[model samples]
Target: MVKKIFYNSLFLTLLSLTSIVMAQKQYPINYFSSPLHIPLYLSGTFGELRNNHLHSGVDIRTQEKEGFIVYAPANGYVSRIKVSAWGFGNALYITHPNGYVTVYGHLKAFNPAIIAYLRKIQYEKESFEQDLAIPKYKIRIKKGDTIAVTGNTGGSEGPHLHYEIRDEKTEKPINPLLFGLKVEDTLLPIIQSIKIYTEDVLHDKVLEVKKKDHLFSLKSIDTLLVPAKFSLGIATYDVISNTTSKKGIYQLELYVDTLLYYQHTLETFSFTESRYINCLINYPDFIKTGVKYQQTKILPGNKLSLYNKHINNGWIELKDNLVHKLRYNVLDVNGNCSELVFYVKKDSSMQKIPLSPLPIIDSNLLISYNKIDTFCTEEVKVKFPAEALYEDILMKYASYPAPSKYYSKFHEIHNIYTPLHKNISLSIKTDTVADSLQSKLLIVRIKDDNSIIAEGGKYENGFIKTNINNFGKFAVLIDTIAPTIKPLNFKDKTNISKLKTLEIKITDNLSGITKYKATLNDKWILMEFDGKNNLLTYTIDNKILEGSNLLKVVVEDSRQNVSELSFELIKKVP
Candidate 1:
């Protein structure tokens, strides 16, 4: 009785601490306005689970087209402007006086004054990509002032504006909805299915799941017979009104007989901790099948701040034969919730079931998550830094004969299902090749479908060395072919008087494009590179004279292979 009372008191204390932390970060609801003039409908929400990281901001839809005017949410200055071909292309940052910052991404064009200022710097640097830090006194903005126009730029998939609200000092992204930015979400989150794991998921793969209406059962059994130690996972999603797009839930709580066993809230998180999402879900299952099941139990090395409460890391240990009730409460940001209830009991008959024998692994193959370890053979060497893994795992290693085109044997360090938090140093020995071809040699990861992904590396002492984040089949390969450059518009010695822009497609076979330059009549001209389409375009301006002019373009690949194109055009525009 005393022990139970002590644990109850400790739980209350922890809950109090959590409440205090939440209260301290009280967000101001009326300080900011909408960045877009249209009704806010989110295709992606803050803290949504993405490929390898959490979605840092919300993606506001732009009615399936571009050129939507984006406004400043509050009175602030343009603190930062970054224009790039990928990843939040043409992003703008504004720092307000209320200790907050607003970010707009994937812009088609900035305001005229800002565009002129950006063009001056771009011309000075002779580069398309620019990242500038603006002073507070320059480019001041008022509430509802037009800052930029939305487009499908950077890594955006469609026409939308990626918006974010962040703490100015810490640079941590906070949910914009918490600051009174309204998104119409009136529907409850949908609970798809729930999975039960009886043992270590990596080694013993005894997983069972079933789906029913609001109630879940293992294999359709009325009461699940689980092992003494077990964990649970759920596959769920949320949806907003007037859109069929599925989104991420805001909060998930697991309760055991009315006691909170685990609680996960998607309020805010740091960018550094976003990669831990690999461990937060059933990674192996996700890699095998494209389904993501969020595990209720937390791994030791998973230090994500999403969890507000957990008892014994959410591992339920059944000591008696009494049936225990399990309940899950899933909620969206608008308080619409869906509940899942089930029952489980421990039975001695479950122990009688035959279990597969654990694989016999070499002692050195065992890797701990908190320590640095190295594994090497005669031809391959890999070094893993501390905290590289989320849990202890047995390192799997194998080698196979390489194909004729490859320079070395295919070294399978491990399966690609696992994820690494930190980069691992990989060194692979290669066969003797001509000195001229040494620079073209690099490591490539061979996928299951026999496709090759170039992992750039440098040749050092007959070995290609590179830092890789994923574990898979790696082999040394050579890339000698130059990038292909094809003109889409006017050809050599053709009339381009009516053409407003010159378009050319540049692509590389193995090593990706590294650099590209274009000049008109010996003067450098601006060519906007759209990497997604492998195209470069130069808008015809005063630089191109009305008579005969020469245009020269040079493109280079990562392996130093270069391709050049020259064209003569007659510009007789009326």
Candidate 2:
């Protein structure tokens, strides 16, 4: 009787869990409503390929204007608020009881009540940017409540509202379309071309595909054959009902001879696994031409969870002389599907392939996968963890002249076109920095666009060590220049009775600005920083007096170099 009871309990628990999962999947469609009052249009879609991560939220078009009223989609409380100069500037998070959370980002301003609350905390903290969490019931909000006003803030390039729905417990973003948010998308996906790769027992070859207007034709008479081992990749994009912009396809499926071989969908993904996009698309092609081609075949080191059902890792073996029919299905979020059909024939030339070459043993070299790999020379050392790379690659190294401001030689560890799955350890030995100024040294990456980005480093045992996410040109640079501050709206000691805001622009040469503070009459005041424009604006509040008000501003860089500006100002609200 006890054993039977135990089995019954286990079955009940599983049944309960299954029911919960089904409900979570269905709740958004039934309960949630659109956050905007107008008909919905999208500027960016969820699961789109970004620079380093998949776009976590959808960008809603706001008609190229700001200050549109943003409403709450469901009944929830304001659970969190983040104020920043970049990345979802002035964002809000609301959690509902339906096991989901809704996020509204790139807001210009919250409702008056929430703005007052934020300002009180900003004054207390004496900082413009803040991250705050509110307890439940503290800010009660119902469905359709006006939460914020939409604008092009933070990293946004234009006026739009960034919206997201997330799993409350897992914190993973759920595609909003999974809910009932209506987006008019009847057009099908456009498949530009399909690439076929031939892999032999010893070598791999990339085939050149012929391009036509819409469909790609593999020319030459049929019956052309290839190696028994082969893979496929496709370049495609989708169009919504009335938009010229091309977005990512929602689903992809591959079939060989009427049998389902592989499938992937963009329903949801965790941020931790988003970087695997570097392995999902053709990384080298993206680096060279900035085009993203989704590889239908799964690579050996790709661990993304997007692939649903795959057979033989999406590889096809043309063993017999049978003709293989290939069909690819691409779909958008709105259920618009497009299909491409092609054929592949077993080739007789594959029989003349040469035998595999013998491997050469090298004690100092290692091609690594699923194990840590290390390389060292007289002046440099690099350690790549097992998970650092999506696939095994021959470690390459070279050195060149550093840029003008750098103190060490530029190390070309590997081509930046190669994508790394995780951060790898890099250490460079140099004696250019004196012990007194070691704290100001940093490893910098020279980007293809000639922009310098700081890769934080520290001095240890006569070597500057850091962890880098990309394989690129790197060198040690010293940041001794302080930030530059220039007043924009007013001159020094000028009378400003009509002006309502004091605007200034601040910038740093290298190792970007770390901290900034503003003071009025030797007391703290709130100053808003806009990172995209490098502008700081301080509004005239009660904190400023009538005449001869002493205003001071101080800014610090990552290297602790400080810049200060003090001037007298007059403010009068006429």
Candidate 3:
């Protein structure tokens, strides 16, 4: 009794403290009229779609031009400056005293003041590609003060301002629209269709909606019964207020007979979980064809902590005459919500649904794979262990039974090691190939004539013997040689002074140069590599000494073969 009283009093005290924080510390919008003086149009609004993660910021349209002056939304100082090849070509981060960090990405160039500051450091470091983190006190700006100009840089699809605000402390991104930013949205969310899932797919029949175009109604359920063992996922998207375009849903709530089962609010999520978007949606189908289908499987392996926590959230057991009611509430950021409800009848004894005329799989064809970097295609088809792949965890295709044994020195099986038991040898059969074809095999291995360190052996149709193994780059033509450097003008033995710059033409026979480092007298010199030209050009920049120098150039391939050389030369100042 004493503990309960103590807890109640503490809760009330904390509640009073929370009320104070919600009032005085409001969003920072009092100073600036708008991030842009132009009619507030968004080329990409908050929570839009992207190739990977959901677009976190609102992209203010720049109206097709470079060098439109970008202003500071509030009084703040620069906290970070990062320049990269893919992400924000030129991005600036400013942290306000009121506790919010506004990020501006894909800028053409910083204002003169910021430019001078950045260039000085870049020259000091002698590198154009760099990330700079500076103290907030170093660079200050007032609201409406011009900070940079708009430009199509980095991975930007076009010229626009990719702006976002993150909590200074938590660093969690919040919807900028929540801060009273004016956006015209009034349309309600739209539901496309619903789907029912059962673990007894092999024994049960599926119920198809009799009609289309409108929400299907249920004929008063006399406690509709469905035998146990199944889950649910819906096919739906949200419709924004000002636009007719289809967008992702903001929130999802699952309830069983008015008792909440599961809920997930997109109000906040960490950036680390963003990669798990593959687990959140149908990753396999999404990769094959660029369409997203949200899966509602609540696999136990899923590590995301965003699921709504409640006793009844998203699970129902089958019982006789039990009417399982599932209510799904979908909402958009603008507060528009769409609800979907249905009754499940508890059927006696599990039964299989009739197979569709078209089978989901074909045992005849090999699943061709393709990629440039990162993942090596392990298998063509991946079947997860119930609710594993699409929703809870991204399952990788692993093969079994040592795949590399077929590779003999006389027989060219380039050191291929199939991914251990991780590879999936999907049993497929073909009539023409026959079971005898299993003896005929295609030997695959890591590139570069490397010996098979690990491998997998599998037979499809009892005839097609396939050797695949360990997940890694299969084609291993290791470029054991360094980039062949040819000076466009500088003769190896001759004095290299007829030129104002030293240009070393370099090329790797195989997996081209991944990195190159040059230095003069042990001091780092910036030499840019133009992959297209196969040239490493080092001009007589301001940093170069106007005297005798020893220049060293080293180039390495992706496989880590190094070719290095040093040149003794005298530089004459122009």
Measured against the true structure, the TM-scores of the candidates, in listed sequence, are 0.92, 0.89, 0.60
lDDT of 3 by residue, 1-574 (tens): 9779557435533442343343223565554345666655556655444554666677776876777888887888999998765677789999988888888898988889888888788769777667888875898888889999888777787788888888889887655655655656555455555435565455323233222222233334323456565555555666554455566666666667756566655545566555445545544445544545455665433455455553422445665566666766666555555555578776666554555453323332222222111122223322222222222212223333333333221222211221122233322221233344333332334434554332223444332233342233332111235567676767644455566777888877654466778888898876655444566767765555566677888877654567888877666647
lDDT of 3: 0.56
Instruction: Candidate 3: list runs displaced more than 4 Å.
Output: 1-33, 41-54, 64-66, 200-227, 239-246, 284-291, 309-313, 318-325, 349-475, 480-513, 516-557, 560-574
- lDDT of residue 490 for candidate 2: 95
Best first by lDDT, ranked: 1, 2, 3
Candidate number of the best lDDT:
1
Clashing pairs in 1: none
**lDDT of each prediction vs. the true structure?**
0.84, 0.80, 0.56
lDDT of model number 2: 0.80
Q: Give the Å error, residue 364, model 2.
A: 4.9
Per residue, candidate 1 scores C-alpha lDDT tens digits across 319-374 of 99999988777777666666666788886655534557547456667778899998
Which sections of candidate 1 miss by over 4 Å? 1-24, 200-219, 352-364
